[model samples]
Target: MHNIMIICPDQSPLKESEKWLSRYGFHVNTSATIEQANRYYEWSEFHLLLIDQDSIASLENASSLLPSHLRRIVLDARPSLSTGVDSMAQGAIYYLPLPTDSETVLKHVVNALEQHDDTPQTDEATPSQQSDEDAFTLGTASSGIIGQCAPMQALFSDMRKIAGTDVTVLIRGESGTGKELVAKALHNLSHRHNQPIISVNCAAIPDNLIESELFGHEKGAFTGASTSHDGLIYAADKGTLFLDEIGELPLEAQARLLRVLQEGEIRKVGATQSTKVNIRLVTATHRDLIAMVRQGLFREDLYYRLYVMELLLPPLRDRGDDISVLSQMLLEKACQKHKRPIYHYNRAFDKAIRSHHWPGNVRELENAIERAVILSPPERVEAANLKLASHQSSTQQGTATLTQQGKTFTGTTLDDYLKYFVQTHQSTMTETQLAQSLGISRKSLWERRQKLEIAKK
Candidate 1:
């Protein structure tokens, strides 16, 4: 069991958190203040500190006073990019945003303790000390899915809870939030772990062939049916059938799917007999099915059936500290994959990522990292190598957006360009100073922060 000391002022959240962590098999203790927490730490060998964000200014002081073995994690009620960066600078190894669920807290605490225990004492490659190849392997193994942010932690908990059940699940998220990964994780942990999992992309299949693709057609069922074959659903009998981009499923196919769910059977095209299939169904889509149902694009009944257990994945830009961790991991992986010398990323690179909004989420970030790794020279990676702003919408193309008075940018919208400039330069300038530099009122700057979805300093 891992030992954790939570320093929080609010009794309600503290009690709730402690109760849940205890149930999850953790040795949890709590203090109302940092001073009291330090006293508790001196007596007990706690492996981690879960400090409230209110005491964040004192974090560095606490770290200096605590034993070297213990790691500090800040628990912010409303975490953001600015606070996340500051916490790391204050010596926090991890940041947990609120209102986080209990399961996410448990996972982060456990994982942090495990990593601390595994760290080498001497004469070994630490995270900063590891080479490209070693860092790629170590980071990937240690940071699978690349986040401990509140949203991701909640998603992890949901996956764990539903893994043992056979109920159908509908995962909803943006295009690159890794919905397919969640499906695979569910199958891997379910009773059908040993059974084969058949994955099909509904949008990838042509509308004319979708029926034949899902429900096998008999030989000569259509003009080109050369041989009688089992469908994907048939192939997945006694296993799992994962339908990705399920919102793109045709109406005719939706009716067929509804019948299969209702009767536990599938009828092949042009076949007289209906075949019984004992398989678990998992579907995912980035579109809103409810809205589609109202628009007559998707069947209401089918939508309800698939929506039995809805899991909404938070977008990448919302996961505060995760971007930094994931970027490093991706950079290392890209370097190792291409057999290039690893390039170290400086604070400027980190600032660049934190400032920009990731519209394409994880997929876009990985591509950017790979591009940088391939193009950058040996030694270190600079912000110019990232080229993230080039991915902005076409409407913003060739439009000059100024930053820091004379520094003009193109491609990205004014809001995004301003966010990038502010976040990158925040460490050097105060809010009032930055607002003045941009030639905008302080209130206007605050309004921009809200409009652009930026975290306040």
Candidate 2:
């Protein structure tokens, strides 16, 4: 029989859980506190430890007291996405939300035990596992997503529910937050994995030819049309079409797109016949399409069709310690790609990453980590080596620096501040660098420049 220990402050659920486990033939013990649990732990070796939300400082604190052989599961009396992330970050084998079915609890316990039994034992922590308490880990990397933070876990849960269906998904987030990766994950996990997942960046296509690029064009359809060509929608038949920055799509194209979504058919440019296509549509945008709709820049009907199911990706800064976790993964990949020696980071590195507000999100973080790997002298990477935007300027405070005229920043709009800052720094910094420093995506910076009418130097 698998042995178990439960540390709980409440009595009712404790008794209820104990009765349920007993019925399943588990060897069980109970304690009211971590101190009491420690005493109980000294007497009997437990295969698993169940701790309620109230008893421990945090899951990390509970993890410190247990020996490596003893696995853990967390019981959240009040469940929320953040608490679930905290549970996984602390290395809990499973997380059980409150009001969970007793049989569900039993099932999780058995699965945890079986996994623990299957895993090979090691006497000491490996180099990768040796780290400070705040370091994040992606224990669920098999899902093809990298974050173990609460928001990411919540997104992962939502993705699993909808991946099997053919419903249209609109992914909304700031640029560099992995909107494309989320789209790809949905396609890979869906029924059309064998087919090509065609991607089109709406902003990159010229307004004059976007129609022909999205819908196939017959020969001599336009000035340069020498041969018939299939558009992204046609190429993506029997597969998925990922439209990145869909908000930038022309209003004319939006009308056509709405028709395609409504009728599941496409008409080629200069062609009398329309062809039927079986395609799964997934679109993502960093822009506010709703606001654009209000401005008459995007079609309301098209927006509604794409927004049937929405996935809002959280920014990197809001994901807590996931920065550290993603840093390690990116560092490993970068090292391999660049032919550099593997380098571990110091706690100071972890501290710096956790403290900085990642404005550029995952994309910016990946670039910084890769640069550190390339520049460091085969030594352990430190905070300074990463060169994060938060440390970009010694004199600048927060997201923007004070102007030379000493204008009061409190009264200024964010757009004004961003425009002023970019104008001041554009001569010395590239647009990409300037965007990173401002904590906005490059595309956002470009839009800001257009609205403010700032001339590119």
Candidate 3:
């Protein structure tokens, strides 16, 4: 029988896990101390080990006593961002934060088993983006987009139905709502699947050079244009061009872009010749473009052109399966990318997942999972596995600040207070710090910021 080691300070959760693994036909070995786990590691090789977060340091210290690689994983019940990151950087195979489920555990384990080939071949692992070269197959066969919720199913259905057509697409969503993912899905499922999906972030580009970038420029059209160049739109001739933050494009650029959409052709900045394109336009924006059009911030014709088909991605709070689906998906990716044996999310970790309203959506979820993966050891993850080290990030990442209730000062709104706070302590303050000082819960702080319109300074 294969060896399975589980280390815990408490007996109840350990006993529960023992039964869980035993039912799965794993020969379970339990330990109450890190010293015993270390001693056991010397005598036996484990298929998987589950370490309580309290004993994580012990397991890591034991790693130095061994010679070659052994499958290990950590179960952190209280996860701090730093410790999790530090654990992985120090050589842990997998990290599972508290309140995690059996399914999340199973997913990581399967991924890890597949990654460890026993062939003795050296393959360094690194994380990769969700790229075209690695497009996900359709149906329930993939782990790419995680969801069993109605909203996700509907969103998927909408994408599948609209992808095959050449109709322009308008994707509306708040920041972190995965608009880019929808855009990619549209292109991936479309007739132009093989062609490139060129992405241009409208807000990131400056107005002075926006024209030269969208349309080709003749040599000497502007300063430093020593060579004639093809523009981004031309490069995406037969594919889909994703215009992100489309509402940020200035009025002048919007007019020229509208002409291209209206005429299916573009003229160079300084060249007299015009070029035709056979591209599909997919635009996304966090702002309300319809309102913008009414206010003359957006062009009506351009709006109509891209609004032929529309899709809106829901935020993480709205996604009912936030914990199960995303945690499992991110775990699988982490195991595969790191070439480590998988682990499970213990009960404590799962609770946090359910309790926390993810302000950063999928990206934040991914970060949390990644932190768990890194903090964990190669052992299986358990409920008491994770430890939360660093505080929450909202106030730190943005300029949104806060003011004490009923403590009004001259020219001071909550937004102004927050801006000053962010500038002063961004490098050190976490959401916990602010909430602690404000005598509020993290969730309450988030709501207050949103209500106050206290955007990042």
Candidate 4:
């Protein structure tokens, strides 16, 4: 059994977590202040320390009283990016946002203990040092992109291979998968790293203004042309120009862009002379450019010109454990942005996140987490806090209504519904099918089965 100490001013909030930890066969002790925590540390060898944010200053002063090998996790009731950074700077293994459920606290404690067990004990080596090393092994830390999965690893490998070349590259991904980041990475790795990378969102510009925006306009180009203006393309001379949502570009602008790629020149609006320029082009879009070309919505020549090299970014649902890692990272970012207390989600929230398809990808996930962080009460976030049910499919929404013995049961509690549904369906449906119908993972289904004592047929 591992021993843990929690240092906080109030004990009420943590009592539930303490009880859960004890029930799981771990010994837990709570201290109302840093002085009491110091005395407890001196009395017994502790595997981990859960320090409250308020007690951090006092704990810092009493740091010399603790050993280097003792694992420490800071729990913040009012979490901000700065406080979390300070805790980590002081050698904390984890910084938990408050309003976290007991299950989340338990998981963090167990993971911290496991990390302690794995660390090679020495006078110089520490868990934080190992964490830093582990971060590099993920392979895209320097690129400002986070992914440990095989698809992302392959994408990173491809990116490295192509980043050095000046070839026109096209990035394809669902919105919010960070295509712009990939485009920036390509620019940074290329020879044009020192040059400016002008980014333009094609869809954001009006149809009439897009042509003038991409290819500079003369003084008398059109209505409201008060003065001659250099387009974004001219600004990117001898550098990289990234056009996001390229499929949204008007056909007229597409023709102008194609000329720049082929002839290496741009003719400003209302100008008779073409100016010679050298620039690397990188474009990204969530639309199907080929389909647009066929539909006459986009120019085929330009589509072929921009499709020289393609980078396909996988959606969040396909990244497996990356979702969990990203959630924590995004949670911290949201907390930091809003200057709110760090918060954590319960097991139900985690389950909801994993089960959701995340149609909008990482962008949607970030927004959801940010909303939860702002709206949720201190320390813990429940599944309802995420409001994922509103985004669920019609089939998933219908799961609440059950038909049994020629009667419809819609008023049953979640436990009553789960018990009835599983027992009624297990005889006919496969486990995977059952899980799918219930809109949850097989692991969650199994856990519910165990919790409610509903055996499979």
TM-scores, all candidates, are 0.61, 0.63, 0.57, 0.58
**Candidate 1 colliding pairs:** none
lDDT score for candidate 2 against the true structure = 0.75
**Model 2 misplacement above 4 A:** 1-139, 389-457
What C-alpha lDDT do the candidate models reach, one value each? 0.74, 0.75, 0.66, 0.75
Model 4 lDDT tens row, 194-273: 89999998755656789999898999878899899888999999999999878868777888898899999999999999
Q: Pick the candidate with the highest TM-score.
A: 2
Residues 1-457, candidate 3: write the lDDT tens digits: 5566777776434346777667767677888776776665543456666667776554546555432344556677666434554544444455666556776665555544443553332223233422421344321323234443556666876877788799888898767677887787778778797999999987556568888898879999888999998899999999999998788788888888888898999988889888999899999987777878888888888888878888888888887644554666567677768887756545566676767677666666676777777767688643332232223333355443344434433333455565445445535666567667667776665545443323322
- TM-score order, best first, reads 2, 1, 4, 3
The predicted structure with the larger lDDT, 1 or 2, is 2
Error (Å) of candidate 2 at residue 394 is 5.1
- Sort the predicted structures by lDDT, highest score first: 4, 2, 1, 3
* Cα lDDT over the full model 3: 0.66
Q: Residue 253 of model 4: what lDDT?
A: 87
